[model samples]
Target: MISGNKRTERFRDAVAGFEAAVRAQDADRSQQYFDDLRRYFGEADDQDFRQAGPRLAAILDEMPAAPRATVAVLVGACVERGADPTPCAPYVLAGLAGALDDARAFCDRWAATGGGDFPDPQAEEPPEDLLDRVDPDLAVAWLTLHHWEMAAVALLDHAAVRTALDDGTRTRLLRTLRSVEEDSGYVFKCLAYALLVLDDEPLVVLDRPTGTGYALRMTGIGDNFQLHTLLADVLIGGGHLPGRAPSAEEAAVCRDRPGQVDTIGSFNLVTPLGDWVWNEGTPSDIPVVDGVRLLVLDPPSYQRSWPAGRFFPHMKGDLVLERVLGADEARRLLAGCAAADG
Candidate 1:
């Protein structure tokens, strides 16, 4: 049996060689290295895949044209190993639609077949709590659901991907996605919104940023670790609800019947837009001024917020970090701009 360190070392070496071959455009060498990488993936434990997945994905992104078969392999291995597919989502969206279908199929099969009925290692013959006996695969799948939400959001904002996909392709992809019944409906809504963007819904700047001392760049928004919490909250209809407080009767209904109605945070937007609600994790159909929209990432107690505001120029394919703007400057620039439609 290979020791964990030895296995990891071999996996890393294979990845490095594969990256070099791909960059050199040496088809035979790349294929050979890919075979080695696939073998490692097949033999990998959770820790091995977790460490290698992102590195492999980053390399794929830098390639001029990501190999579809290689993308499919990485996605399939992630599903089979119960790893998060987030890292590979860009490739999946960029025309390898079947990969997403295959991953979803694997997820569905796992759900139908026992869905993790492993015996509890620590418990007695018959475990009292079924939760304790859940197979790690199911737990990993549950965690991956969160990643799926982010992926869905990316699909919405990926303009380059939309340009590559025609109407028929978008429709087919949407149908494929709808065929799968997930554990939660939130991802479906997010995905539906993304599909809408692919069809005809023009991508617009959704918010106006406020707050001082914010810097901006053009890079992946996921790099902003601080906004993760806020983004998740907004995605799940958990953003601040302002206006008049809920009536006594409304409060009682929410308290007594929790699942029936969605709950929301009891705060107001720090950077309030005229009458816009920041519920959905999307930009509104606001008119873009000179191909630019304002995005603000304001944490509760601002410490060292770099991108407190971003000036996005009509992004279509890959999302980037645009230039930064001060709070006062951003507000001044966006003062006259209004939503194209409600």
Candidate 2:
């Protein structure tokens, strides 16, 4: 049996050989090296893959020209075997730069025919003909990455690639992706929310107490005023729902409740006296009740916010939320943000 160290060394050697072949633009030698890399990938345990993934990613980063077909195969294999696909993102994005026009055109045609919205590839399988209609290289990358929004989000990350496209083309692609993003029931929902909350903190309510809830302070990303967005963040980033497990820290802090806390389900923003500050359709000119002002954060959902409706799969019950920021507050916040920027 090959010792772990020896196997690791061989994997590194294969990566180096692959990089050298790519640098020299040698097709046959590249294939031979990639075969060895494939064998290593096939045999990699979790520890081995985590260690090797970064190295492979580093090589792909340096190689101006890579064997796109083999790279797709390797990335696809990584995702198929239940390993992280992050390392493959650079290569996927590189290929996507060339395929964006093709993807955008396909999406435009699909929308014209009333295809509606795109689904999360992880939670829901895409249509059989979907990949067939796209550029072959783009389809392969998506197939391996197991995401439709991957290309769109990847394009956003690569500013050079994104700006190279004509403004009209970029806008069309982004608009299509945004529509798909809104309807998705999984991680993409979190991503959409992140985009919405860019450069501004949103509110989030943590429902530990049964009657009154604890509102988390707006500090950083993932902490949003919207419960759905916060829940989406929890599900995507932590790989677990908030209701499923109570934090030991939360249990310690929530002393008013003797038993375990239930933090899931629909919530309402209320005052200290348990009066409705905001829930569902509360209307615009929300009066300052009892001399306290509320930080209103009612962003649009898959549908309008009212009477609590079901949208994402991660939710246990319906959610009824308040209205968006009022005109004065919006101006004040934006002005403050601008001043900070200046």
Candidate 3:
């Protein structure tokens, strides 16, 4: 076992090296330092690093104060390198708590510098019994952290519900989102919300006319992170109702709908507006008609390796559609439609 002092020295050196490489704009060097940092945390093995959570947490606690973004980057880097910090869920949670505290502090400092009254930033305390509720394995912890990180963003912004973030931070957060793309719809929604909040321009939500009902869509220059979250919130908050599940009747009706419906797999149907899945084997090509409006969730990528049917399970009378396209794809599709309309 490594001595505490030795571990501390290793962490500090690794952090310093990473920072230096970033400053030098040496992508290769920065990545090398990141690898070193991961190795220091016992992620040298191909196995998920979640087993090393305790060690990783101890090292983080020993470090001197660092910037909120820096902390996010470090943790993110570990995640990117496949180090599962789940076993150290408590430590990861604590780290998140610390980062939130740091964000509040930074905001306060900024307020003071501007001579403005400090906004009573909300304090988000991670659930004390998180470990009790979640497994301490790396995958579980990764999912848990993924959930909390997005929640932290909302809490930090006081559930701004409409606040935007700096471009740099937005990009960094999106990169992190990309890493967790294969996780679940819940993770994707959180990432989308983060991107929406970080965008520098105005966004509009559009609803596609499907038969008599409508499906909501978001149009923007960059990632439509907000739109995805909005869709998720709508689906979740709408109670995943039994009526929402596409039925054989609806599928037949959808076939004649505006967009062509291609069955991607046993469970899913890819439509122009959005993808849909059904518990029954019969696939439907449904268009977003009425009753669908984009409402901000106020919450909230990757080639899926799993088969479509197994990937999205029917949950309590509802089916989940993972993101079929990224922001750029959505834009291109919409742009082509607009051109044709013109």
Candidate 4:
């Protein structure tokens, strides 16, 4: 039986050999190298192999220097294993930069060999220009991972409406969306809200009155006001009325009628309130008083300028809280109106 150190050394050698074969474009050798790796890593289900899987850094060290090709391989591997690629992004980015440089070099060589008929491929093509030559769907796949919205939009624009995405590409895109969604909390909902506006999806007022302005609010998750603000901006950017940014009237109302708007939306973070209101009964049992059609509740534990007494009643009893309001009073007031309308 191989000692751990010996096994690790063997793995490293196999990885180096595999990468070299890939660089040389020797298919038979590459296949053999991969077969060795697979066997060493063990037949997928081997307990020892699973427990002793190589670190990401080790795997990255063994990958070919060609960025694009290596990224493709890594992405393919991730899809095959049903794993997220986020942990590997830094490595992927490094590889992509190398691949892009290699592409430039290859273009230069091609033009030189073609005796000046070919355009100088080394010229820094506008991202738009690059979009023209590469598969637009693949470009979108990569750009999406980086949250390069403008590039992704442009790439998707170039893609044929009927173009089919490869399974790997589709999975990567979904993973990217999920990552962005998780990072930005309500961003996906904001985007959906924006698309709804575009599709003429009628916004219904929540239980609140039509003239009442409402905002979606969440408890602060760290110093992450920027994420919340960005989400709100995305919703407004979608060209909808009563946008995420409070209009003058809405702002004025929040300032004048502080009692009507409940600030703080989500309970994801550990606020001074200690813990979240997990049981629906805590929120549902609260009575909704008249004049305030929408009552905003803070986590019962949060001690702030907004007294818990004002909103807690609305959350109790059979009343089901339809929408969450953010900690920003102005925004919550606005989103409450928006939710009601939707």
Candidate 5:
């Protein structure tokens, strides 16, 4: 029993650490945590780990996503090494599918803007009544983010990624031929970068400097962490940048409602899923090699987040921060700008 308790403690820690890495959007941290998990896996016998599979799966699913990319690789490795993960098979597979869906969505969303193409800084109209479903601010954020992603995808597909690859390599990194044939293929890097950037959304901004504030160079809008929070956690923090974060009293007035940022100390229970399930556990199945392939996206093609260079040298990064305005107000603003230029 003591042994089991110790294992559980360590396992939970490892899982928590991995999830934290993912949320932090640091590949190196994620890899290191995964390595810790692998070491822990070896500490116990195959049957021992297998018995805990369901628990692990439940934990992983509790989070906003499952770390499918890592779990899939771990499962494959265990199988190859003659370890039986049967007890945990169902859980692992569940996490794998969920993680893959999130990854695919994340990547496909942003990769559309890859290569030398640029995201249109200008905002566009939403589909009919889109604002009714979500706040005007959130609606605009989604449109802008989606546009940038589309531009990225175009940049990636335009020979920059394909210049040096056997068909197999390209397929693995981009899509299997079958998927492309069926119009179902998606880029691995797309999923990877999506998660990375989104993880970087909820920043811990202290008044005092801490290892350089969340400049969020890659994203547009100086101090634009709020938009990412809306996307990643599906709730914006309570406060506007030009002003202080919302006060507890102010937040109390607006709590439990959509279309508003949350209070700083507010309970995270009001997440998109209506509860706090974050950091319970996360799984990833993307192999180290695939992660390496995503290195090209490390640098912000448009902003200054990474110390790395742009994936598309020909493309230039421009800040694309969101600004809210009514239809008439927008027209007036544009007209004013045009006149000023003239």
Candidate 6:
């Protein structure tokens, strides 16, 4: 950890660089600064963040929205980064006050009830060279362990998700992998199947066999506010309604952006909250969905803000997504798979 004053300086530098990047209209630079800010919180002396985080959040929040990512990421980073230590829990919880009121309340409720750590286990070490050959669906779970933490700990006992996996036997999956992230076609497909089973909605993956344009067949639309964008990023990173999924670089572009949607990526999202927009390098204020599977995308890309409320898979926005499917299509695919198993 960087020592006291130096840690403070690092915190200031991150906020300063981000603010300057936004003011200068440097999209990429602002993104870099945001990434640095996240890193500072993680690496700076843990206690120093207790002082700098809220101040940094206030400063970032005051900046113009066009050049900066959302203030929530900055604030969320503070809470998550400081979460490792038991003593820092209250301080970290304090940082989540406004942006993650739901999460803060959860912390209170969970604490008052005498519990800690969500359903997800903290960390595990795997034997060397063991994780390399893990099944793709398992590989996806390992990746989720890194990105989303416990929110990715969906039940494996579910019949549909279990049936969807390539291997019925757990042999050869000896290692519990951590820190390795490789995209998997199986992970993409299985996540879709699992999500469809869980949502129990008529989900669909709006996509073509080739090229871009991806989203869900959404209904009973409501305000996306926070949950939709976070889910979109996680869904994409894990692979989504795959008309065409994002390449590695494209995923970075979407995750780093302040709002939902990226100029370069191929995916768009429609959530009950709102639609994921600005798809295929076009700025579309109003959505255009014509076909039965037509997509109306959401505009804000994924950022971390509501993890305390269990809103996203990752605390920060850096990972890539692929092999995607939307809700309606996911349901359809699962049905087919179930029939085949039967």
The Cα error of candidate 4 at residue 13, in Å, is: 1.2
Query: Which candidate comes out best when scored by TM-score?
Result: 2
Error of 6 at 101 (Å): 13
lDDT of 6: 0.35
Report residue 6 deviation for candidate 5 (angstroms). Answer: 10
Model 3 TM-score is 0.29
Candidate 2 local lDDT, 112-146, one digit each (tens): 55565553334455677765555444444333332
What does candidate 2 score in Cα RMSD to the true structure?
A: 12.4
- Lowest-lDDT window of 10 residues in candidate 5? 292-301
TM-score of 2: 0.43
Ranking by lDDT: 1, 2, 6, 3, 5, 4
For model 3, state the Cα shift of residue 96 in Å: 3.0
Q: Over the stretch 104-195, how does candidate 4's per-residue lDDT look in tens digits?
A: 34343433444223222223342544444444434333333332222122222211210222445444444544443443232332212111
Clash count per candidate: 13, 5, 10, 48, 34, 41
Q: What C-alpha lDDT, on a 0 to 100 scale, does residue 45 get in candidate 5?
A: 50
TM-score of each: 0.30, 0.43, 0.29, 0.26, 0.24, 0.23
Q: Provide the lDDT at 197 for model 1.
A: 45
- Model 2: lDDT equals 0.40
The prediction achieving the highest lDDT against the true structure is 1
Ranking by TM-score: 2, 1, 3, 4, 5, 6
Whichever of 1 and 3 has more lDDT, that candidate is 1
The local distance difference test score of each candidate is 0.42, 0.40, 0.35, 0.32, 0.33, 0.35
lDDT of 6 at 17: 82
Compute the lDDT for candidate 1.
Answer: 0.42
- For candidate 1, the TM-score is 0.30
In terms of lDDT, the poorest run of 10 residues in model 3 is 307-316
Displacement of residue 336 (Cα, Å) in model 6 is 17
